[model samples]
Target: MASSNYEVIRLKRDLPAQGVVIHQITDDRMKTGVPLHDALDRLLEAVKGKVLLVHYAKIERDFLEAATKRFYGKSLPFLMVDTMQIERRRLERTHQSIQSNQLRLAYLCQQYQLSK
Candidate 1:
């Protein structure tokens, strides 16, 4: 891999919502930014054997597909579990009356009394 300076800001390890934020490259931060190709390569490797659980998959899939095509000359193939889709399917199976905002993450969580 090509050498580059990367600044990874990780939340506390004990936090329930652990995440890492890679700062965007600005004129001042250019020296510390990894190229898009490198970032995508790393992301692909990290998620290779994982099933992505997302609130909405379409946006994620579209962005990844575009990135993979641009960087690797191919489409990204990965499994995804969309919570919104799951709720929609469940509601359909039960023949429940669906509200306009029923499938939204916040709405579903609120309906189920789950903490955001």
Candidate 2:
């Protein structure tokens, strides 16, 4: 779902025994300011029954926590898997080096050959 203030990308795939859906929420409301609950609502609707949430960082978790407080009673239930953490694990396991002071995703992707 694409909105003027935000763009939500959803991908669904059916494995041999299970179904999975992934949601990517881009924060385009930097100036206009979209509500956290609104974004969470869209995310919840997209991954209502999926197993995992693959997000770039822990921002999604913080967003969900705030949204849950905003809604009070209604919130989605799911586990958040930070892609950053996954990459960090892979780099540590493989003993990759960080040349500079930056820990960007591009660097991690290159180290892990996860770039597309």
Which structure among the candidates has the greatest lDDT?
Answer: 1
Each model's RMSD to truth, in Å?
A: 10.2, 12.5
Clashing pairs in 1: none
Residue range 7-70, candidate 1, lDDT tens digits: 3323223322222222232343444456667777787777778887777899879978998998
* Runs in model 2 lying further than 4 Å from the true structure: 1-35, 74-76, 99-103, 106-116
Q: Which stretches of candidate 1 lie over 4 Å from their true place?
A: 1-38, 113-116
Candidate lDDT scores, in order, read: 0.70, 0.53
lDDT of 2 by residue, 1-116 (tens): 32222444232422322222222232332324445456666766766665443436467666566667668665545576676777667768789964452255666667568642
User: How well does candidate 1 match the true structure in TM-score terms?
Assistant: 0.61
